[model samples]
Target: MPNKLEQLKKMTVVVADTGDIEAIKKYQPQDCTTNPSLILKAAGLPGYQNLLGEAKGWIKSGESADDVIDKLTVSIGTELTKIVPGYVSTEVDARLSFDKDAALARARHLIKLYEANGVGRERILIKLASTWEGIQAAEELKKDDIRSNMTLIFGLEQAIACAQAGAYLISPFVGRITDWYKKSTGTKDYPVDEDPGIQSVREIYRHFKAHGYETIIMGASFRSAAQVEALAGCDRLTVSPQLLGELEADEGNLKRQLTPTMGSDKEDKVSEAEYRWSLAEDAMAGEKLNEGIRSFHQDTQKLKDLLTGDQAQEKRAVAQTGA
Candidate 1:
């Protein structure tokens, strides 16, 4: 019998949710994804020292720390493109989540940087938070053939809005949703089939397939291998290295849990007003979305600080040598 990871690949596209090149080589997932947090973690890895040095070199060339961060992001993404056969998701600045124009401009710049590095736009998915402004930015980018992966999705309304905006892909956070529910209900464990996270993805999957929306649904932010196993037949799943290793070791019989089903209701395009109202009503969605953005933004700032510290050290070394 094949391992659970191999079995999962038969029904869904497995995506590595880390920035570790060594892990990507070992698992050989179909795609790879990175956000500010993942990139920050990857920056400290021994293998990425050259990329970090190059980014610092950009600072010596008069690029600001922010610009160097962007360059480093694309540099890391360029390396991932060589390993993954499918798309690599590079995120926009999380602080720009609510600013449509700035987010759009940043996404375009990231794509341009990737192209400059010889990785075409086709191999990249510009990741954005699932804010209203972010959705609008994605809508306009799609007009120019730039695909986007809408991340931090917590509610079905967000998924519907992204689908209506013609987003190339949407990543519904499974573990985060479960985390919210578990805290609220004071429950420690949930049966695999009854897991709130798994149920959330199943709802989104059914809605998309039933309504004939072309946008792909990719489940992200898993907590356990059981959560991953529950959504085995999803369109795609972006999993962390720890969970991937667990799945690789388990030789359990994985069954197809989610499949397309026809629905009697007609599809409705979500308006901005409706989208905002839906999120406002759903406390979990609103809070989680805000929290996710803040967390990513914090990591972005931390990355900048790490680079700035390096820059300062280099300057002191030069001054001491001259003296």
Candidate 2:
């Protein structure tokens, strides 16, 4: 019997959800994703120092810290494209999540940077938060032939909006949903079948498949191997390095938990008003979306600080040497 990871790949695309190049090479996922948090973690690794230095060099060329960060992001993304045969999701600034024009501009810049680095827009998925503004930006981006991966999705409303907007992919965070439910209900254990996060993705999957939406559903942010196993037949699952190792070691029979189903329940497209109202009603989704944005923004700031500090040290060294 093949290990669980191998078996899962037969039915679903396994995406390495990290910035660790070494881990991506080991698991060999079909695609890979990295957010600000993952990229920050990768920035600290010794192997990525050259990438950091190159980004800092941009700062010396009079680019703002934000532009330098974008360059660093695409620099890492460019390397990943060499390894993965499929798309690499590079996120726009999280702070621009609510600004449609800014998000669109930044996404365009990122794509241009990738193209300059020899990776075309076809190989990249501009990751945007699943806010109303972000969805609007994605809608426009699609017309220009740029694919988008809608991140921070927590409800059916967000999923439906992304599908309606023609997003290329949607990442429904599984572990974070489970985390919210556990905290709210004060329950430590949720059976695999009854896990809130798993159930949420299953619901979104069934809806999309039944409605024949072209937007792909990729389950992400897994907390355990069991969560990964439960959603075995999803369109894709972006997993962390630790859980990937767990799945690679376990030679278990992975069953197909999700499959396509066509239904007669056609629904109207979700308008912006309806989308916002529905999201507001879902307390868990609303809270988690806000938390996810704040967390990503904080990590992005941390990355800027790291780059600025390095630049300051270099300046001091130059002055001391009288060069």
Candidate 3:
């Protein structure tokens, strides 16, 4: 019998949710996604030392710190593309999450960098936070043929907004939602049927399918293979190598739980005010969404520290150049 992983591949597109190129090669996922957290983790490994050295070399030249970081992002993404056979989602700076114009400008800039590296927009997904502004930015980028993956999404509001704005894809985080519920309810376990994370993705998947939206539903941030199995028929699932391995090792039956037929229940489109109010009312989504943003923001700053080391030395060098 084929492993559950193989069964899953028959139902949905499996994506590697990490920055580690070796992991992508090992799993051979159709696509891969990365964030500041994953990139920072990858930068620390000996395998990525050369990449870090390359990024640091930009500093000795005339590149500004932000430019160097952007270059490094493209460099890393370029390497990932060599491994993964499909799209690679590289994020804009999380700090620009709430600024529509800034997010749009940076996303366009990221696409240009990818194109300059000989990877066309077809293979690149410019990831933005799923704030209202981020969704708006995605709407504009769509007009230019640059696709987007809205990340850090937590509620129906965020999901609806992304779909309404014509985002290319939206990553509705699953593990983080389950984690929030477990902590809030003081429960250590949930049947896959009752898991909040799984249910959240299922609801979003149902809604999107019901409405015939073009935006793809990619369930992300899984804590277990069970959650992955639960959303077996989602458009795509970006999972860590750890869970991918677990699925590979288990030759268990995996059923398709979110097919188009299951999503046939219809509803009206939500207004902007109602969207915000619905999201605010969902306490779990609100807390986790905020936490995800802060966490990503912190990881991005850490990546900045990694890319441009020795802040005092940098300051001294800048003062000495005095040009």
CA-lDDT, candidates in order: 0.90, 0.90, 0.84
Q: Candidate 3 local accuracy as lDDT?
A: 0.84
Q: Which portions of model 1 miss their true places by more than 4 Å?
A: 262-267, 310-323
Instruction: Compose the digit string of candidate 1's lDDT tens values, residues 28-108.
Output: 999999998898888888889999888867777888987899999999999999999999999999999999999999999
In angstroms, the error of model 1 at 240 is 0.8
Q: lDDT of model 3 at residue 184?
A: 92
Q: Give per-residue lDDT, candidate 2, residue 213.
A: 89
Estimated TM-score for each candidate: 0.94, 0.94, 0.93
Error at 15, model 1, angstroms: 0.4
When summed lDDT is taken over every stretch of 10 residues in candidate 1, the lowest stretch is: 314-323
The sequence of per-residue lDDT tens digits that candidate 2 reaches over residues 227-251 is 9999988999999999999999998
Better candidate number, 2 or 3, judged by TM-score:
2
TM-score of the candidate numbered 3?
Answer: 0.93
By summed lDDT, the worst window of 10 consecutive residues in model 2 runs over 314-323
lDDT for each residue of candidate 3 in 1-323, tens digit (9 for 90 to 100): 88998988888999998887778888899999988778777776667789889888887776776787788888889989899888999998888888999988888888899889999999999999887788889889999998899998887778988899989999999999989889999999999999998888888887887788889999998988888999998999999989999999998788889888665454547677876777689898777777878887776666666557787754543333211
